[model samples]
Target: MTAQDHHSTDLQRNLTNRHLQLIAIGGAIGTGLFMGSGKTISLAGPSILIIYMIIGTMVFFLMRALGEMLLSNLNYKSFVDMAYDLLGPGVGFYVGWTYWLGWVFVGMADLTAVVSYLTFWLPAGASFSPIDQALISAGCVIFLLLLNLLTVKLFGEVEFWFAIIKIVAIIALIIAGAYMVATHYTSPGGSVASISNIWSHGGMFPNGVNGFLAGFQIAIFAFIGVELVGTTAAETKDPTKNLPKAVNSIPVRVILFYVLSLVVVMSVTPWTEVKADRSPFVELFLMAGIPTAAVIMNLVVLSSVMSSMNSGIFSTSRMMFGLSRDAQAPKMMSFLTKSGVPANGLLFSCACIMGGSLLQYFVPNTIEAFTLAGTLCTILFISVWIIILLCYIRYRKSRPELHTASSFKMPGGVFMSYVVIIFFVFTIGILSLEDDTRRSLVVSPIWLLVLAIGYFGFYKPRIKNQNTPTKKF
Candidate 1:
């Protein structure tokens, strides 16, 4: 079959309002919040709450700009397409591949998180060897791969339920925490739970400016998938209505899921005492005298990691499919299964994700591996977000008519786009304040260099030859 014939089958619009809404919520509530918040609390004290809000506010504005651009043209599948149409093919190629790699890193980090949570279920003296952890990570990847191969609707249904579980768990924790504070319940450590606990230890900024900056590194990772809904635009049933609804709800989800949940946890456990090596969610329930808290919270966090990983697989495959159609990737990646799923791209992404299991043998320490993956994903994601903003700026200048006609306009328009871009630049600067994140920053440019080499040396030349006129003999 010709390349055009191979990609003739288009992705279906099977995702509904409910699916899109929950997917957005699920994306916003990443595993980082559940697993990494403990360390953030420890580093920044109660001020981590403010950090989340600041990040969330900036992200909401970013999403608004993204939503406006996506709505301006229903033909655009994802921000990659928007980048292609507004910026150019070269920029689109870079964004598509970089976004794919970002999700791959996120998948690795999620797998590491799953193994860490599973260890909670083991006996005090028992632990998973490197082989055992690798096997578990492989099994999880295979299971998610099989599920995504079914249909787009199934992916949506799975995310809907996954998001519901996360929402319910956080709500229960918040309610239980409020009751504890009201009743002044005393923990095993003799620390009394009270509203004043948020600031009593050493005031809100107990760890000082450096500590506050340290919190941004992990806290930024927690918000990595917030833009995932933009990827569903092609498969969404009604782009104009559903896309805006999903984007509009981001602020609410951030406040409830990130800010409020952490406030309750710090109030109950005190930020100074929150363990950097463990999940504060599990610890909060354990301190509440819930006998099976570890088991239950472990299960909840395991599901959370799986949810994010599922998202990673779905997004990477879709991105690959898009890139292949644009002739920026291998043609085989664009092939669709009978169910309208990008089967080739899906399998390829899963294969890459399975490689993450090997980190257990090489790194040994799960937290260290997780941190490295998270830092890399954060840097890549920040780059993608910056590109999206740049696309919006280009769109405004080139096609002012579209901006004028946009029903869901970005709040500040071009000015906000520049502001958000500067904020991302500042966040990258914040990553340099720490040793762990700084390493990723140093290694990130190498990926871009490789992309530059691929584009100029290979894809660009091939496209040029294909476009040049041939002489008839």
Candidate 2:
């Protein structure tokens, strides 16, 4: 069999360099930057800029480690496959399911965001009730299911256009904000556009150590999908060339889309005046006296959530496919359609997402539901990242020959892996200090316990049968 056939049993390697580039871009930018930045800025003041830089740098290291292993073996599909080979079957199974759960909650959160944004256009009364929103959320889940079922290329195509809209919107906002600052124009809120706004209002770290740490809670979530490009290792064409380029460009995306954009936002308006609940993008345009500021911003924000939800579905289905191939999940999930799409896996993931909408329908308090769900997602995602770092460390020691032979090596090597791992542990410790997020830290252990049970109880028995014979009689 050819290398392509040996590597991908069902998934087609149809995603080109263009698709990989856009997927990387889409993964880096999320609704969190557009909407949640207002709150993060309020929490951390001008210091939020530094917060993004720190997190972005660490994530780039994690991606480098992942890319190294992925390129080490062309037959290896994702981190899931690498974990199976280097860290043993247990690590692979655990990471695979937790990763799926992480994205499932992310999709749930974005689904709620979709409904909330839709309320902007609808009348506030019976036209926008909980039932109405639930139905709309279900419709969105169905739409994503259909889109993903078509083909991997189509999934990449949708993400490409969605990412373009975000890229264009941010570039335009930055330009407008720069102009207002250059002219020293005043906003309707009476705040003047000046670079001094970053430090003038209570200095950079307005909220002190406590507030600076608080910003990490939400800002970290913004970077949740940055590792998504790693998941596309199987479908990507010319992964060696395309994957590294996609991974290396993350630092640029972070600087431009995140740091520069936020600098412009806070510079145009004082950090203290920014509303925690509203999007800074909309507020910035409104400050510049744009006629359709609300409509334009709403459309862009809608696209942001749609992009996130689409990615959530894609990643979750792929994870399920990996899990099933290893016999860690339902065997049916491994079945693929003629187009090389994992239709069963896609359908199962959407079913779970629809359940998120139902939770919103039954639960009267949306904010509480969102907080609990978001916290769980943060915990699970952190675990997945830690697993990737840990697997990289194991790969270095267990397969020294591979490391010595590789062209693209992780910059810091094993020492950097330890540093990143310690950093992640510290972040978890920080999460425990907050009342809102502490519960997730407490609840996450239960998930690990359950995965342990599933691994021993189900997947272990099938491992011997799954592996090939080493010697012929």
Candidate 3:
């Protein structure tokens, strides 16, 4: 028996250590890292390795802060809900809806990418067209959403495998790269480019300090969904126990899956050969003389997208469900079907995702929509992180008595939260340095502004006692 057994929260604890672990892992690995890593390498050159490590470490601390606050009070289900309780209903409304929009945009971009990857298996002439692909991708989106709406276990199982597939693939790539590196062989030949591919190009900071700094703009996107684990605490069977294990392992996974993988990639192929708009995973496989590298990588990436879409549905519906129980959102979204599922909320998000099908179908450029969607992801992610920071700061002031009761405390306390907020602000400022990313920088704030308006316009203040007794999270 564990201490969590004797001390359970009000929200129904339905997830296990395994469920929380996979949820965290699934959030950590994304289609972007699989696809956009090549672009990252192109932008920062070899210094991308250092950039990932530093960012991963900082994010680890951020999650730590979140974990402490979440476990600080059992009343907290989703982070936004917690924000509302600790701060006010306004923060919850704004953060919750913004977070939902973030995932919606992320799903749209990922669904489109899935279809684009599916193109590798289709005829070249037919594959290049965006509209046809959107139709099929939309179908895939429906299939995954059904899985989410049907069963919580189904969503968990699917995400488990989705993460495992990405994990296994990254692991395999690392091994293959190690083999090439040991043999002193690679596609592009140069002493510095060979073994020294990581730093020899321009002494690690090839493009200078600013180029490495610029990597954070996109790097933040890869870490966008990492907070999904925090949202899942409501569903975890032993959130107090399992959540800690899952949260603690984030650092290890980030290092093994991201940092180590990038080292092998640049070591085996050299950053010089990596293209601006391509995936390093595909490039590495192709360089290894694997004939179907394109198709195989596509399948893996498609699977990653599907995993995220499924998760997006689950997370948004749960958030809506939490809000509804508190009377912040529409009652329909809160109503659960016989199986205890938020049927209306799930359908609502799916309906929004279906709108993406229209987006991909009618939008003149698939790439532009994808880029805009990516920018939206960065914005929503940063906003949620910021909200968590403010919530923690308030938690310390309002509930100093309960802080000692928490088993897993966010180290460094308010100071850490303040530091992370500044780090995020700096990241946001750097986003404008590039013209392509500048639009996203400008657009993301507008999205948050819209969320702020919705909170004040539509919802009433959350009553303090509204969530007194609730089992569903």
Candidate 4:
């Protein structure tokens, strides 16, 4: 066999179509959807549904472009691989590190959220100190780290069940909401829970153009993990077939999990009635007279947060592995266990999460820390998406033969690339309008500056040395 053929066996293709399907579903339905939907509904009223659909549409095209490029060269593992080849090493290094940090922070945020959720069951008074929560969060991370270090299939199995919980919860919520609306059940507040609640509260765009724009801030975060499916390219059993099927189902998942769920929520409880500080899912169950609403929603959300952390770990480990192969990170990170898991990278990522957990423990304001980390994550994710689009554009031009020969060509091709890029720009501009979100806009430039310094100061010199031949040799 050829040397390349032998090396291909290093990453075992153990992820079946089933794993890909649910990972896609779980990735699309994030903690943001559960935690932030209440605020989004209050912000945009019924127009939030439109906002979700718009973002979902743009992301669909973006995934297709990524999938097409991935399929074009089976050697490519993730978007970073595409950037390294189509763009330059500088683009690759920047995008890779940014994406890694994005997940690192995501893992951090979810780790904190998990601790907060766990504290609900803690006995009040002295037993519920921040130390206890930190320990609990650390334990949970350790459990996930151990499970992930087992095998790729194990990670897939865990995600599959986590996704099943989320799906069933959403489906059950929709059914219950539909039943309440059909019977014209009135909430405890005496407002008739009807489909009209969507528009009855000061019409569809209740807050006008500005309120509608406000929805984008939270709604965009809801879709943060949607591109996670793209990260599974290397482990997938059949990328050409399974990848396309997973990509095609994104819109369906978004509609069902996001749009439909929100519609049912607002219909059962008016948008204005939904509390910004609480989950709408819990609110709906409580309004329907379920005494265990908080407990039930807590369990579901805990699972959702765990799932997000799981995905973050998986993506970050894989990213570090790719970076090591490119000589952009410590070579030890590229080593794999007998089961094809990146053990060193996994441990390194878990260590970072542990540090963030300590930060969450010391910080008196958990919300502020969450906001800062989440905004940083969103900005970095957006940057990576823009890079993917740019790489796709470059792929089309530099390899017209491959573009034309490929079966899964992006529908609008390069034109759609520009369209999505512009949409991202519009979203960034919208961030500037909000006082709370504007900090993300201001801080984003500093992040770019750090990345520039890292790439030039560290990666550039080593890359030049590695590429150059020694005269003595």
> Quick one: best TM-score, which candidate?
1
Per-residue C-alpha lDDT of model 2 across residues 1-473, encoded as one tens digit per residue? 54334333677898999989998899889867876687788788999999999999999999999999999888888888877777777787888999999999988877766776676676545245678768888999999899999888999999999999999988887888899899998877677899999999999988999999888877888888888998998999999899999999999999999999999989987888787756777777666566396578789988998999999999999999888877788988987876788878899999998877786687534444555566778778888899899989998988899999998899999999999888887777878767878887787889878988888876776666667332110
Q: Which TM-score value belongs to model 1? A: 0.97
Candidate 1 or 3, higher lDDT?
1
Global lDDT scores for all candidate models: 0.89, 0.84, 0.74, 0.84
The top-ranked prediction according to lDDT is: 1
Which residue pairs in candidate 2 have backbone atoms (N, alpha carbon, C) closer than 3 angstroms, thus clashing? none
Residue pairs in candidate 4 whose N, alpha carbon or C atoms collide under 3 angstroms: none
Q: Higher-TM-score candidate among 2 and 3?
A: 2
**CA RMSD of all predictions:** 3.0, 3.4, 5.2, 3.7
Question: Alpha-carbon error at 122 in model 3, in Å?
Answer: 4.4
Cα shift from native, residue 259, model 2 (Å): 0.5
lDDT of 4 by residue, 1-473 (tens): 64333333367889999999999999899877887777678788899999999999999999999989999998887888888788878888888999998898888777666765565576653234667667877887898999999989999999999999999999988988898899999877787879998988899899999999988887887788888877898889989999999999988998999989999999988888886645788778766676486588779988998999999999989888888877889987888887888888899988887766686678535445555666668888988999999999999999999998999999899999999999998888888877777887798788789988888888789878778441110
Instruction: Write model 3 residue lDDT over 256-325, tens digit each, in one string.
Output: 9888988987887778788655567776766656657546766777788787777888887887777676
> So what's the TM-score on candidate 3?
0.90
Deviation in Å, model 3, residue 85 alpha carbon: 1.2
Of models 2 and 3, which has the larger lDDT?
A: 2
Worst lDDT run of 10 residues, candidate 3, spans 2-11
lDDT of 2 at 408: 88
